[model samples]
Target: MRRILVTGARGQLGSQLLRCAEDKGLQAAGVGSAELDITDRDAVDRWVEPDAVVINCAAYTAVDGAESDEAAARAVNEIGARNLAAACSRAGAGLIQVSTDYVFAGDRAGDAAVPYEADDPTGPRSVYGRTKLAGERAVHAELPSAQIVRTAWVYTGTAGGSSGAGADFVATMLRLERERDTVRVVDDQMGAPTYSVDLAAGLLELACTGGRGVTTLHATNAGSATRFDLARAVFAEVGADPERVQPCSSAEFAKPAPRPAYSVLSPRSWEAAGLTPLRPWWEALADALARLG
Candidate 1:
């Protein structure tokens, strides 16, 4: 049996990975941020042992906040990735890194949402994306065998009894639904809402392939969703009127971090790995709501 070291054990994906490890009979340990400061190279060097695969899930996930804290985000996302890769290389272990879909520029001029491929041009619109892309590069630099899996709009079934619907897409929707009677969500951006649990299962297969060099894989759910569509879905799950959710544009919800108007990652790598396609976002959302109930 191979030992697996999972960084950011308490994070969304890390938690899912932990559950999968138990279900799939894999030997794995997910460590929290308190135990492993991924930004510290020497600390990482001390922590990593020989012959253990490293899957880095630790990252600065504050998308809007990263705009003002690029330095800190890069330190953790880019520099820390390099640190992990170096440690893994020294120990002769493989590395699996998690990335994001924010790396795209969100050009949706055509009717079809651009299917971002592994070789597509990376035009990041936010600090978070830039740092994540740098981290992907860093992993390849130190350990050519590193695998990067990029996912987007990750959510779980049970967020401590809270509704997953609109939980992420429309934080304001949930607030307004509770406080007022109506709310508006941006309808411009489109992205796949990835179920962390499903994505985690796929990662294990990719890493165990033991393939050489860095491979960027997009492992999101099958369908894409607009913020408006996602909000309405949440309201439906809660037995609230969908009409209460209104449609708006990015201009109305101007945030510091520029959201990609279209950030849809394909599942070709998942197919290549012979893993079944992830369930539809709506299906996952329903399961998530059931878990909440």
Candidate 2:
């Protein structure tokens, strides 16, 4: 049996990954941050045993907050990653880490023009981005057979559950449409909003294909979406008023973290890995919203 150990098991992607592994007949156990403190190098040492593929899903996701708390962010994103890499190395297990698009600086031109490839020059604008990039670098350097999967705008199966990610954009929009007469979302920023369920399934599929080691790959929904368009889709999916969600520029609500204006990562890696494309955002959104209700 392929025993898979998923960290951040309580997280959005981690939760979905556990479920996917179960479906594929893999013995998967997810230990959340509460169960294992990855930043504590000894904790990681004790947690990882001699067998099983390790997937690191836990991350400090606050983009703006990371700007102010750089040290804490590094401790988690960078140091934590290395700890896991070292543990995986010692255990002789494959490492699968989930990363983000923030590693890229937002200076790329046009909305849908720049599709960040795996080998692109990483110019992270935010502290969170830099730390995550550092973590990726550390993982690759330490654990040779680790697979780093970078994704964006993830929505999980439990996105509407008591957990955090479930209460994210889709749930928020659904709530806003019900209570508020109108909701304004940023239109300038663009990304390939991925579904965590889809991403999790895809990750396992990639791993099951018989490859091991550290290779960077991107996985997300097929199409690009502005935050406004995503909000609109959510409203529509839940049978809410699409007009209630209005389009606004990111400049209107400036955030501390400089969000990438456009981060439409290419799905070329999926094809390269001989895996099928992930589900489109529109289709996944409808399924997710319907499941929510």
Candidate 3:
């Protein structure tokens, strides 16, 4: 039985991975920032053991916040990644580093929207994106055998039934539906919504199906949607009037960091590795909403 250690155990994806790992009877242990700080090289070195597989879910995911605090973001997303990669290499263990689709500049013409591939050229526009890209480069430099999985629009439905800033879009929409007469969402930004539970399963599959080599793969629920679409779906699911959910431009909801006009990540790499792709976004959304109920 291979031992597994998950960092960022309290995060959306990390928490789901820990839960599924235990439910499926896999040999796994999880630690949050409190127990193990990847930014601390000596601590990571002390925590890692030989023959273990480290699933690194720890990351600084504040997109807008990173605009003002690039240094802090880099500490966790880049330097921290370097520490983890170096430690994993020394321990002679396998590593799976979770990454984000923000690595892409996502400024393509709306009509030219395309799913990003694992080996595609990257040009991150935001500090958060740049730092995460640095993390990927760091992992590759130190531990070329590490698996880097990039995902986007991730929501665990833990944050008041939505996903975003620890609260997901679903949760936010559900809350808004009850509080307001109408919900305004951005329709221009396009991407796939990934349920943490599904992503956790995919990571496990990647770990177990070991023909290991350093690989970059994209994983997310199939299909694409805009925030407007997602919000409308949420309204429909909750028996509210979908018409109350209206579409707006990104400028209407401008933030500190720029979001990719398109964040759809290609699933080709995941499928090429002989792993199963997650179900359609709408289908997964239905299941997730059911669970939240």
Best by TM-score: 3
Query: Which model is ahead, 2 or 3, in terms of TM-score?
Result: 3
Query: In model 1, which regions exceed 4 Å deviation?
Result: 157-167, 170-176, 209-214
2 against 3, candidate with superior lDDT? 3
Question: Model 3: which ten-residue window has the lowest total lDDT?
Answer: 157-166
Please report how far candidate 1 places residue 124 from its true position, in Å.
0.3
Count of clashes in candidate 3: 9
**TM-scores for all candidates?**
0.91, 0.94, 0.96
Residue 39 local lDDT, model 2: 97
Q: If candidate 1 were superposed on the true structure by all CA atoms, what would the RMSD be?
A: 2.8
Cα TM-score of candidate 2: 0.94
1-293 per-residue lDDT for model 3 (tens digits): 67889998877778788888988899999899989889999999998989888899999987899999999999999999999999999999888999998999897765677888899999999999999999999998999989899999887665632212357777788879989998889999989998888999989888877524539999999999988998898899878999999999999999999999988999988888888889999998889889978
TM-score of 3: 0.96
lDDT score for residue 48 of model 1: 79
Residue 215 shift from truth in candidate 3, angstroms = 0.4
Query: 171 in model 2: Cα distance from truth in Å?
Result: 1.2
